[model samples]
Each structure stands twice: as structure tokens, then as C-alpha cells.
Target: MALLYQFFTALWELTGAMAPYILFGLFFAGILHEWLPENFIRKHLGGDTIFSVLKSTLFGIPLPVCSCGVIPLAASLKKEGASRGSVLSFLISTPITGIDSILATFGMFGWIFTIYRVVTSIVIAFIAGIVSNIVGERGDKDPAGSSASPIRPASFRADPPAPGQAGGACGCDGGCGAEAERGFSFFEAMRYGFVTLMGDIAKPLFWGLLIGAAITVAIPENIGEWLSGYTWLGYLLVIAIAVPMYVCATASLPIAASLVLSGVSLGAAFVFLSAGPATNTVTIGVVRKMLGSRSLIVYLATIVGGSLLFGLGLDLFFDTMQIDPRSVVHMEEHGGWATLLASVILWGLMLRFLLPPLFRRKRRCEGEEDSCCTKG
Candidate 1:
């Protein structure tokens, strides 16, 4: 019972810390979605030059898409003439750090950790992009000299459309040109921010917080001291766990914070933060199919190796500076009324998206009387 109370308290505090910043991040994302044209991404990433690779890295850094969400966008970029290097860079950079994630990192960790995360993500992505250019297969073309279609397998192609594309009658796709054609409105931007983007993240965020609380309750504080002598092992373990998981950038924060509080080294926490949202089993398969096995190798090597190097550097810096992780965690707990209000609003939005309406369910049952009645 005490453990249950601790778990809920930790969950609420973490949610409050993240909620306000998340709202701001979502609004900014909506604005970016409304302003940036898809063609703009395609235009800049078409070349194999270093400039294109850098552009891809920088452009991807602030976007809010998760690892699974990014696959379709990356595929579209590939089909629309983005170079292999640029595509790899975008894939690496986009999921690991975003505006929302950055803000949440600051709220949970500190400015210093947030800066390290953003810098390391860009460096890793850039290195991966350059290596991919050097070794990856040339453009998307088959040996028969025919243009290859989307790299995703036909079976996997049915995943939801990229966030800003038309999916249904709402015309909620944030394509600027489409908005202009239909007459843009602020209400539409609000809808995208509060509805579409919120809907996309709600389920993942819930699971992330739940797992974070569980970790908080399950892990003993002494576990940190037990692993202190095995820093490298800790890093490796975190990478192994994170690499195949599908946690999103924003959702990863609470989990990382919980691990740190449980006495995991900050470096190991960094590894989880970088690797968790950046790669997953589905993402790995997509990269292999899209960029060929060679590029896939470069992608995986860069993320793993770069994450370790960054993690080690961070640990060394903390040691030299005599910084305490607990002190940083204490600093993050300054949330007040704004945080409380934001948490409430966020929960409401998440519940709205995650739960099916009774009216809609009843209507569906009525429409399928034979099946519904038989089940009843």
C-alpha cells in the first residue's frame, strides 16, 4: 500500500512537471505544421552533399514525431528524392530530441543535461548521415534501372498516414497549401495542436508514465550503488532495453527520471534517453529495407557507439564538477499552480483521445445488429 502511494505520487509529480511545457510544445508543433510545406523538406534533402545532411539533422531536431511515427515520413522523403544520408540523419535526429522533449528534459533533468542531449543527438545523427553517404547504396533504384517505390513493405504500408496528410473528412491535415485553398483559420491550428497531436501521443505517454512509476516503486535505492562499479555494464543494459522499445521523446522523460532517482548513473540515464525513442525493432526493419543493409549498419553503429561515448563523457564531466544527481532532481520539483492546471488539461485531452465515446460505440453496434446482438 505504501509502495502504491509512492508510485502515484511520483507519477503525478512527473506529469505536473511535464504538462505545461508539453502544451507549449504542442502549440509550437502545430504552428510548424501549418507553416512548413512538405515540399520544403523534399527540396532541401534531395542532394547527397554534406549540406543536405546537416540540413536534415537540424530540421529533424525540433520535430515531435516518435520512432514509429517517423518511419512513414522518412519513407516519403526517400520516395520524394531525399538522399540516403539525409534520410538517415532525419531518422536519427527527429525521434531522439524534439521541442517538446527538450522542454520536458529541462523540466525533469536540468539545462545542462538538456543541452548535452540535444548536442549529442545532432552529432550522432550527423556522423551517421556522413557514414551512410559514403557506404549506402546510391539512389532509390533497382538493379534493373527502374525507380524503386516506397521502401516500406506492402504489409507495413497500411500504418497511419504521415501526420500532416489527408486521412479523413476533417481536412485536419496541416498542409499549408491545403489550408490556404480552404482558407486557413486559427481554430484549425488549435485543433491540430489539441486534437491531432494530442491524440497521437496520448497512449504512448500514458504507458511511459505507468512504467516510470513502476520502476520507481520496484527498484531499490541501493541498486544505484550496486551498479556504480559497473558503469559500462549499466550503459550497455540501458541501450539494450531502450533500442527495441517504442517510447516517444516526450514519453521517455519520466522513465529516465525515475531510473536516475533509483540510483542509476546519469550516463546510463542518458543512454536510455537517446536510444529509446530513436530506435525500435520496427524502425530497424524499416531502415534496413529503405537504405539497404550497409546503411542500416551505419545507422545502428552510430547510435550505439555515439551514445556510449556521450554517456561516458557526461559521467566524467559530472565527476570532475562534483555534481549531484539528487540536487538536479530537487531543482526540477518547483512546479506550482500552472503545472497543476496544465496537468488537469492534459489528462482531460488524453482521456478524450484514449477512450471511445459511448454514443459512437452504441451507433456502431446498432449498425451491426447481427454481430453485436450475437456477442451480447
Candidate 2:
């Protein structure tokens, strides 16, 4: 009971710190969705060259998609005129960090850490694309050969998940749907952010919060001090856990914070941040299906290797500067009325999206499927 209470307390505190930024970030994601041409990225990334890969990476960085959410969109790019490398680049660059995740990161960590995360994502994504183009096959010739893209695949084996599926839960956000009118509407943006995108992530966000709080309760504070010199162990452990698990960007912040409190070095915690959001078991299957076994290997190697390399650099930077990343943490944004209100609102929204399905499932299980369970 005491452990359960502690877990809830940590979960509430972390929610207060993260909710405002997540709300703002979701709105910003909607704005990006509405403001940009629906086909803008598709139009640019259809090339087989490094430039196509770069564009895919740049465009993917700010978008608020998770590892799962990115699947259909990447598949679409592959089907349309995107090169395999471009598709691979898009897959990697996205989900490592998103706008919502970035703000939540800044709210929890600091500007320097946030900046490093973004820069590292860019570098890693670009390297993966270039490597893919060099060694991975050109699945389809693009416009350079009077076709569409070298970075784009001519054909992908598996179809993206259907609309009601996990990856397609938010109407596939930017991935599976046809182009929306590029004209911006404030109402549409709010609906997309608060309703569509938020709905898509709400369930995971709640589970992530529970997991984070559990981590806090499980790991003792300042245990990191003892492991300070064994950063490699932290890296390996995080990779082992992160590569198979799925955590969204915003959802990952509190989990990372739990590690930080447990004396996990900032650099090692960063390995979790970078690796957890980008690679997961489900996504591994998707990559293999979309790009081939060879590209799948390249994809995994790049994310795992790049995460380790960048994580090491981050630790070195702090050590050389005689700084402790833990010192710069800013989780004190909690305990205010404003934060409490935000947490309340966030909980309300989370429940709104999460409860209906469970209720409907119950109805179905009770053999009421022909009744209102049908609507659900």
C-alpha cells in the first residue's frame, strides 16, 4: 500500500510538471499539420540523393508522431515516390523527439540537454539515410531515371495498419489519410491537437506515467552516484530495455527523470530517451516488412550505435565542463495551483479517451455486442 501510494504521488507530480508543455506541444503539432502543404514532404523526399534524406530528416524532426504513428506515413512515402533511404531517414528522425517531447524535456531537464537531443537526432538520422543509400538497395528508381525516388521504394510488402488499429488510432494522424486542405483553421487545429492527436497518445501517456512512477518507487535516489563511472553499464541496460519497448516522446520524459533520480547519469538516461522512442519490437517488424531484412539490420545498428555514441559525448561534455546534469534539472515546476489545474485537466482528457473502449469491451464481453456496444 505504501509503495502504491508512493507510485501515485510520483505519477501526479510528474504529470503536473509535464502536462502544460504537452498541451502546448500538441497544439503546435496541429499547427504544423495544418500549415504545411500535405504533400510538401512527399514532394521533396522522392529523390534518391543525400538531399532527399536531409529533407526527410529535417521535416520529421518537429512533427509530433510516435514510433508507432510513423509507420503508415513512412509506408506512404515508400509507396508514393520516396526512396528507401528517405523512408528510412524519416523513420529514424521522427519519434526520437517531437515538439511536445522537446518542451517536456526542457521543463524537466534544461535547454542544453534539449539542444543536444535535437542535434543528435539530426546527425543520427542523416547518417542512417546516407548509409542506407550507399549499401542498401535502391528498391525503385526515381525521377532521376524518369521515375520518382531512389530514397523511395517502388513497392513495400506489407500494408499499413487499418484505421482502427493501434498505429492508425488517431486516423493515422499524418500517415494513412489523404491530404487535408492546406488552408488553416484555428478550430481544426485545436480539434486535431486536443482531440485527434491527443486521443491517439492518451492511453500510452497514462501507461507511461504509471511505468515512470513505478521506476521511481523501484530505484533508490542518488544510486547514480555509485554507478557514475560505469556509464557503459547504464547504456547497455537502457538499450536492452528501450529497443523492445514503445514509449512516446512526451511519455518518455518522466521515465527518464526516474532514471536521473536513481543516479543514472544524464548521458545514460539520454540513451533511453533516444533509443526508446525510435526503436521498438513492433517497429522492428514494420521496418523489416517495409525495407527488407538488410535495411532492417542497418536501421537497428544505426539507432543503437548512434544512441551509444551520442550518449557518451553528452556525458563527456558535462564532465569536461565540471557540470552535473542533475544539477540543471528543473522538476520544481510542480506543486503550483497552475500545475495542479493542468494535471487535473490532463487527467480529464486522458480519461475521456481511455474509458470508452474499456466500457465497450465490457459490454461486448457480457454478450451485449448487438446493443450499444456496436456503436463503440
RMSD of each: 6.7, 7.3
- Model 2 TM-score, all chains together: 0.83
lDDT of 2: 0.76
**Per-residue alpha-carbon lDDT of model 1 for 217-329, expressed as tens digits?**
89997998899888878998999899888889999888888888889988888898888888999988878878888788999999999988998998889889998765666
- Which stretches of candidate 2 lie above 4 Å from their native place? 138-182, 357-376
Model 1 gets an lDDT of 0.76
lDDT of 2 by residue, 274-376 (tens): 9898989988987777777767788999999999999899888888999867786666668888888888989888897788765324333131112111111
Q: What are the clashing pairs of model 1?
A: none
TM-score of each: 0.85, 0.83
Return the top candidate by TM-score: 1
